[model samples]
Structure formats: structure tokens, C-alpha cells
Target: MTEMTYRQALHDTLREELLRDENVMLIGEEIGIFDGSYKITAGLLKEFGARRVRDAPISEEGFTGAAMLGLRPVVEIMTINFSLLALDQIVNHAAKIHGMFGGQLGVPMVIRTPGGGGQQLGASHSQNIELYYAFVPGMKVVAPSTPADAKALLMASIRDDDPVLFLENLALYNTKGDVPDHVEPAEIGKAKVTRTGKDLTLIGYSRMALVAQQVADRLAESEGLDIEVVDLRSLRPLDRDTVIESVKKTNAAVVLEDDWLTYGIGAEVAASISDGAFDYLDAPVRRVAMAEVPLPYAKPLETAALPSIDDVVNAVHETLDAVGRRR
Candidate 1:
């Protein structure tokens, strides 16, 4: 295994896929000359040339619709905040084409974008709007926290014969982790058990999954609590079975998300536990989510609005306390 940053892992995977498949091409604003907003496509233009590394105008809807018709196009929307501009194409056409045409046609395209707050891009630019795409039935959403999973999941998404929304967290770009030397594509709808515990289950995806790990370590050291951490790698085809099984074993749960609380991904997780493990649960399912407001531009406000390690730790403690399991 080789240690690499999350951004480098994504870049390497894209480069590997582009070389491996002739049909796979990239499309996005400033992806060519600018190397992408986050440099995920840094040197692709030079290697693949203009034909494969194509750039588009600032028309998300237009280009997204056009890319959907092409052969295995991986389009980057700059950021999830900007993805709102392409919602009509994403929700109405790309998502519904296969079903609308009775499976005769499929939009085998991947929409890659970063979300979550940390750099203080203000309310307009900094927001975890993954719930928008995750709510849609036709779109497949996956958010990987580690460099290894990032490469594997992206490889899988590019090959899938359906529309996929690859959600990246802005805060995770610089984070480094060990990536496999011979990486394999990860299954799209699976949750990974990162840590084992019996006191409570802490579930999260993307950035929150990383945070959950941190919380688990703290709880283990400070409170002598055995907290299990489940990373929800894929959001759309959510691995409810894994979540339910973990909750059943732990008998308690606390869902952490970078998005807002109401109607967020946590709500679905909590509901799934209630449906499948209601009798097994020893306490109410809890959630830790961003403040339900436009993420503020100021540093302090943004930090407060976004969910943190402390917030997750507190939620876990509260859930354990509710079940009288706190040490």
C-alpha cells in the first residue's frame, strides 16, 4: 500500500480509468486549462489531449445534458453548491432516461463534485447539499472518506450503467491515507464497519465518517466506551442491512451528517433502525447534523454551523446515557 492524499487518489483513479477505457472521457468547467476547480483533473488535459479532456461553458444544465448522451462521460460540476444549476437535467432527464425508455437507453454518466464546509467559501459556495441528489430515486450517490475507498468507488461509478453522483468533501482533500497498490472497485451500495463496539453505533458517510472514527477513538480512551463506527459509503443504495445489523448488536445508534437535520440522511438511517431493529434498540436513535441555516461565511459561524467531532462525541455520550450505558 502507498500513502496518498485524497485528491491524489482521485486524480490517479481518473487517470487510470481514462487510459483503461477508450470511451471514458472528462467534461467540466475549467477542467482542461485550469486543471479543475480542485485540481482533481490536473494533468489529464496534457496526457489525453483536448478531445478527451474537454472543457465546457458555465452552463451546467446544457453540458450535463449533452454529456449524458456521450460515451461514459465523467462530468465535474465544480462543487455541489453549483450542482443546483444542473438539477433540472440531473433529476428530469439523466435520472429518468433509462426508466422512461423502458431500459432501452441508460445514462452511464458520473457527476463528480465536492461539498461540505471548512474553507469558509461563504453560504453560497459552502453547503452539504447531497440530500438533494440522494432524495432522487434514479441517481446513485456515493461518498467515500478514505483515499482507498475514493479510488475504488470512483472506478466502480465510472463503469456502472446508471447516473452516479460522486460526492467529495472539501475538508477531506488534503487528508492522507494508505491506498492499496492493486486497487479494486468497491461495491456501490455497501457500508463498512470501521470499528467494533457494543455500547453504541455511530453511523456516518463522507466527512462525517472520518469524524465518527475520531469520536470513537476519543470515547475509547476517555470514557472506556466501545463505540462502533459504520461508514455509509454509498448514500442512495444505502446499506440499510449493515446499519440495522450494527444497531442490533450495539442496541443504540447516533447518526452524524454534514447536512442539515430535518429530512437529512440521518433521518432515513434512524427510521431504518426503528423499522428493522426497533425491538433490539435500547434507546432512541440520535442524530448530529449541521445547523439548519445557510452555512455562514465567517470562520467561527461556519465552524459552528457545520457538525464537528465534539458534536458527534456529545451525541454518542447522550445516546449512551439515555440507555444507561455511559461509563
Candidate 2:
């Protein structure tokens, strides 16, 4: 295994895929000359040349549409905030083409973008709006919290026949972890249990998944509570079974998200637990999420609006206490 940053893992996956498949190409604004907004495509243009590393105008809709028809194009939307510009194409065409046209053709494309607050990019540029795509039916959504998962999931997404929205977290770019020399593609709709505990289950995806791990560690040290963490790697084909099984074992749950609370991904998880494990639940499912407002531009406000380790820890305590399960 080799240790690398989250950004490096993604860059390596793209380079490997491009070399492995003749049809695999990359498209997006400034991806060629500029490398990329976050440098995930750095040095790729020189190796692949202009034909495969073509740059598009500042038209998300136009380029995204072109990618849909192209041969296994991996398009970068710069950031999730900018993906709004291509929502019409993403929701209308790329997602619905296969089902709409009676399976004659499929949009085998990968849209890579980063989201989450903390860089002070302001309300417009910093937001965890992946729920928009996750809510849609046709597209598949996957968010990787670690370098290893990022590499594996990217490989899987590129090879899949359906369109995939690869969600990256801005805060995770510099984070480093050990990744295998040779990795297999991760199954898209599965959730991973990062820790084992019996007190309560802490469930999250993307950045929150990492945060859940941190919370679990702290609870283990401070409160002597065993906290289990489940990482929902794929959001669209959410592994409801994994989540339900974990909650059943723990008898309590706390859902964490980087997005706002209302109608957020946590809501779906909470409902699933209620439907599948209602009788076994010892307490109502709890959720910790970003404040329901445009993420602020100021550092203090942005931090305040986003969910933190403290928020998650507190939620776990409250959930446990609600059912007198706290020791």
C-alpha cells in the first residue's frame, strides 16, 4: 500500500483509466491548460493530448450534453456549486436517456465535482448540494471519504454503463491515507462499517463519514461507549440494508450530513430505520446537519453553519439518553 492524499488518489485513478481504456476521455472547463480547479487532472492533458483531454467553454450544459453522447467521457464540473448550470442536462437528458429511449442507448459518463464548506468560498461557491442529484432517479451518486475508496469508486463509476455523480469533499483534498497498489472497483450501492459498537450507530457519507469516525473515537475514550460508524459510499442506491442492520444491532442511531437538515439525505435514512427497524429501535433516530441557510462566506459563520464533530457527539449522547440507554 502507498500513502497519498485524496487528490492524488483521484488523479492516479483518472490517469490509469485513461491509459487502460481507449474510449475513456476527460472534458470540462479549464481541465486541459489549467489542469483543473482543484488540480485533480494535473499532467493528464500532456500525456493524453488535446483529442482526449479536450477543454470546453464555460457552458456546463453544452459540455455535459456533449459528454452524454461521447464515448465514456469523464466531465468535471469544477465544483458542485457550479453544477447547477448543467442541472437541466443532468436531470433531463443524461439521467433519463436510457429509460426514456427504451434502453437503446445509455449515458455512460462520470461527473466529478467537490462540495462542502470550510474554505470560505462564500455562500455561492461553498455548499453541499449533492442531494439535488441524489434525489433524482436516473443518476447514481457516490461520495468517497478516504483516498482508498476514492480510487476504487472512481474506477467503478467510469466502468459502469450508467451516469455517475462522483462527489468529492473540499475539506478532504489534502487528507492522506494508505491506498493499495492494485485496487478493485468498489460496489456502488454498499455501505461500509468503519467501526463496531453496541451503544449507538453513527451513519454518514462523504465528509461526515470521516467526522463520524472521529466522534466514535472520542466517545470511546471519554464516555467508554462503543459507537459504530457506517459510511454510505453510494448515496442514490443507498445501502438501506446495511444501515438497518447496524441500527438493529446498536438499537440506536444518529445520522450526520454536511447538507441542510430539511429533506436532506438523513431524512431518508431516518425513515428507512423507522420502516425496517422501528420495533427494535430504543430511541427516535437523530440527525446532525448544516444549518438551513446559504453557507456564509465568513470563516466563523461558515464553520457555525456546517456540522462539526461536537454536533455529532452531542447528538449521540442525546439519542442514547432519550431511551435511558446511556451508562
Estimate, for each residue in 1-327, the C-alpha lDDT of model 2 and write its tens digit: 999999999999999999999899999999999998889899999999998998999988888876555589999998998999999989988899999999888999999999988998988888888999999999999999999999999999999999999999999999999999999999999999999989999999999999999999998998899999999999999999999999999999999999989999999999999999999898899999999999888889888899999889889989988988777
Give candidate 2's whole-model lDDT: 0.93
Top-lDDT structure, candidate number: 2
After superposing candidate 1 on the true structure, give the runs of residues whose Cα lies further than 4 Å from its correct spot: 67-70
Summarize candidate 1's per-residue lDDT along 58-131 as a digit string, tens digits: 99987887544558999999889888999999999889999999988999999999998878888888888888
What TM-score does candidate 2 reach? 0.98
Question: Which 10 consecutive residues of model 2 have the lowest summed lDDT?
Answer: 61-70
* Deviation in Å, model 2, residue 79 alpha carbon: 1.0
